[model samples]
Target: MTEPTQDSFPVTPTNKIRVAKRANYDRDTLFAILDEGLIAQVGFVLDDKPIVLPMAYGRIDDQIYIHGAKAARMLKKLKEGLPVCLNVTLVDGLVLGRAAFHHTMNFRSANIHGTARLVEDEKEKYDALVAITDHLAPGRWDETRETTKKEINATTVIAVTIEQAASKIRGGMPIDDEEDYDLDFWAGVVPISTSFGPAIDDARLKAGIPVADSIRKLTSRR
Candidate 1:
């Protein structure tokens, strides 16, 4: 995710929230969070009406690529050039608390707000689809066959430039109020983790793909 990038999308022009500033932005840092997960919550407004929808995404260069069935209401609405905010967040841990008021979760999140555009170029769309596949499973892009003409025709892809985005991170133990901190109780982080499970081959997996080594070596659980 850290390949050097121009990050042509400037952080200053796009941020609306001051709490979530872009000073901490480093392409490698932000996009790694985007790359580690496939789901994103996209926010948009149509005709003065607001919308936020969660969908799958892939990152290529400085753009966030997302797709949904053409019939998806969010997709249909977003295709109208509405301004959108895309949120990608990963919960890293649950903070155990001495008081309910102190309960919190350690997380990494990025919120991007900007106008989204429907990708009309066939070549760019093809590349974006491959990036989506690669984002889900690294080697699958090369291993899986390309999208069929009909499949491409039916899918809708949207791209959001990596403009002003704020990355907010919360980690470590809960900090209870001064009075509550003295309460005798467990107050530490309950670590949460994400991992890829063993690849499950289809019963009909054809002859010799034999699960590539890249796909086989996964999972923290035995």
Candidate 2:
């Protein structure tokens, strides 16, 4: 693929997509996929072996933030500036074809390449935490109790600047062989979606404490 313009991340060997037709280099496309995703698969090398872990992440501009316990192995290794690759995917549907070989899925996914660095600035760390919390449920940070110094101290946050990224998207019906088109078999897409269920209050909550507005708003949207 050719190098993309300024509006998109430049195409590089590390971030190139083999299926050029499905590749998208636009910043909007990449960020859209990232923003809608609830989990990210982070890949890195540890002890000369490859490791991939699912993590909760938040995006701020061109960077992604991931946090965990201070002593977590992945956080410790990534904070040392090791190369990392993060991926988020949302399955939109299941594509069923007449032939078994043509069965596939409709999905949107973003893959990012960068190096993670420990967040040292106090304000930045706090903001990153808020972004993460809101990513899970909008406006959740403001609706909850403030984080204590000890809680903040025990958590470790790392920022990964998006150096290179690409998004791949597939939608619509399945493609089958010309001969299979006339076969007596079903072929179509089964749409898939994610929705939020009614909120359940904590068992230990005090009497008369209703659901927070953030939680109500989030569930209502779905």
Q: The CA-based lDDT of model 1 is what?
A: 0.75
Top lDDT model:
2
- For 1-222, candidate 1 gives per-residue lDDT tens digits of 222346423456454335553234555667777877668988777778776777878888778889877776777777646677888899989998898888988888877776788988999998898888777677667876666998988899999876566666787878788888777888899888777777788889887767765466444332
Query: Clashing pairs in model 1?
Result: none
Global lDDT of each candidate: 0.75, 0.91
Candidate 1 deviant stretches above 4 angstroms: 1-23, 207-209, 217-222
Worst 10 residues of 2 by lDDT: 1-10
What is the per-residue lDDT of model 2 for residues 90-170, given as tens digits with 9 covering 90 to 100? 999999999999999999999999988889999999999999999998889998888999999999999999989999999
Candidate 2 pairs with clashing backbones: none
Off by over 4 Å in 2: 1-4
